[model samples]
Target: MEKRLLGKTAIITGSARGIGREYALRMAKLGANVVITDIDLSAGKYKETDIKAKSVKEEVELLGVKSLEFEGDGTDESFVKKVVDDTIDTFGSLDILVNNIGGTGGAGPGLATDMEVEKFRRVIDINLTTTFIFSKHAGKVMKVQKSGKIINVASVAGFVPLFVVQPHYSAGKAAVISLTKTMALELAPYGVTVNAIAPGYISTVKWDAHFEAQIEDLVQKVPLGRIGTTEDCSKVIEFLATDLSDYLTGQTIFVDGGLMELNPSSSKIENYQI
Candidate 1:
């Protein structure tokens, strides 16, 4: 809000909607030029944010900062490389990279033993591989500049086991956390900090629409006594994206409402999903 990232450039993946969208808007509010990249730029057709514009890119421009919109598959290495190149060519500097493109890919059976082969692979590619590709290209630019921040979006599922299904999602996120630490060490010499935010029970348009009836029940399990908002997740990204976290690297900050502290075992909880 104080324009801490003034004149900076941030590229957020899967930011057409959900928590990623919040990250883009937050960066823009801090005076950073935002690049809205997603497989579907029109993905937000399901719901609307408070600041209504023709699109998220428009919303960012409304904040008095430049915005670039690129729609492409996150798993495509060529597309990702182009995004990185084009951002540098236009922005003159790559100050921030938020790897927010990931999901369960809900195509396979949920159980570990019963998980579908293709679905599991797709989940890993979208979450882990996508992160690596962006970091690889973006790191090249950041390393040259000798300053940058990379914030990866992980999930509580990566840290703890769940009674619910979706083993592929869990495994993919766990790998992301590991990758973040590795990248942190690799990029530290270049003054590039790599960190991750693992959120829990965030209420997004798609999540709410799917679990609307179970919202209250899910909140009851959270010690905070409420559902987490996209802003809750984005605020943490803000910290990691700014100088405030300059000293921190190779860290995974959990944005959960103390949900992981419980460390609930599968036997204790019945099919709970985070």
Candidate 2:
């Protein structure tokens, strides 16, 4: 087996669990030392669930790559700066950054009008603002290296409404999509590529916790005839992180089963079967 990212280092935020955890594990197998950051670390309990930074680190190390776990709020500017600095100090180079943090918290299934201002702001911080902070700090190190790959985790909500009611979450993810374009342009000259991955209906253990209801009806809508898996998303990230996607930048990849950017009324296919 060949490793494309041998000796390279990657920083993936919110990697204590779910999609982010998958990224850390996969990247390690691809021979990239992994830096895993998550708010769950700040609480020092992994997560309310069983997945924790320690478990992720152990798995990544088993793949024979160094893994660093930092505990803090990803939305904090100072914390982000420190994390970036520590990455360079420890690994000596920052090769890839996966900004995979964002979600709707306590206030579940909310209409825009019914949401509290504070909650709205909180969602934005978790999703959008944190992306900005990570990208900005990570870009600095990549700029000095004169080469880097930055991948942001947007959502299908960034492009279209989902079955769930999450107005603020949608807005924040859309902003991340926009940020991908702008960052790509800003960092292109520095030999850095910035892109966002918008995923739809990815089924995870975490998803079962809050969004099992979304599964039944949503799978039928996907042209691929099934919901996505975290590995499905990570494989795409693996591509974008490599030089094979060197020409790809300033773009958003919709990792849906052809569910997004579709006009259901005008599709040539009347129905899709698995």
Candidate 3:
């Protein structure tokens, strides 16, 4: 609302759809040149409320901010390095990095007993490892600049074991929270702030039928009386990317509509003393 991100540049991964897309739009709206990448580059394919990188880039341009779109894997170090380098080459500065390129995206049953070793590894690679790879490169540039912001997308499962049976997803997100804190601590002296958003029951187009049917029940369980939205998390990303949150670092801000407060059994809430 304040054009808070003016004169900055950001890279947001997995920005083809959902929360990543929203974050990209919000960043651009606030005047940040954006570099967005999603493995899926199709422009109009997900017309049924799908947000493609092409469409996202177009919107960024419409907002009057420079944008570059890429279709690459964030888990690949080479790919990450190239994008970060290219963003610096083009924008001349790397002011922000939003690691929105994560999710459960599991194909097998999410239960630990039913989860395959490959599935567990894949989930971690996509969610946690990607954050590590991307942040490592971005951190280097930000360190030289002596300023930057990094935001990673974690989930409520990372804090409290959800009833939906996603052990692999839970583990991956939990690791992301840890990664955020360690990065925050490592980067603070250089003026970089690292944080993670643990979203709970966020509404997106790519949900299973069961989640759609159980929406009402899930809302009741949430103390806020409604499912979280992409904008809810994007707003927090906006804060972390700007100077408004300068005093905050190595923090995992829960954007779960008070769900974690209601469920105190989580060891995660205590694990993050950073």
- Best lDDT goes to which candidate? 1
Model 2: number of clashes? 0
Segments in model 2 whose C-alpha atoms lie over 4 Å from true places: 42-54, 261-274
Task: Go through the candidates in order and give each one's C-alpha lDDT.
Answer: 0.88, 0.84, 0.82
Task: Residues 1-274, candidate 1: write the lDDT tens digits.
Answer: 5999999999999999878889999999999999999998998864765757878999999999999999999889999999998998999999999999998655643777776688889989989999999999999899999999999999888877554576788789999999999999999999999999999889887788767878887787788778899999989999999999999999999888978876353124345443
Sliding window of 10 residues with minimal summed lDDT for model 3? 265-274
Q: What does candidate 2 score on TM?
A: 0.91
- Model 1 scores what on Cα lDDT? 0.88
Ranking by lDDT: 1, 2, 3
* Descending-TM-score candidate ranking: 1, 3, 2
Worst 10 residues of 2 by lDDT: 265-274
| lDDT score, candidate 3 | 0.82
lDDT of 3 by residue, 1-274 (tens): 6788898999998887777888999999898999988877562356536443348888788888999988888888898999999999999999989998776664444566766798889988888999999999999999999999999988878877675456677788999999999999999999999988888878876643447767776677677778888899999999889989999998888898888887444333222100
TM-score of each: 0.95, 0.91, 0.91
Say which prediction, candidate 2 or candidate 3, comes out ahead on TM-score: 3
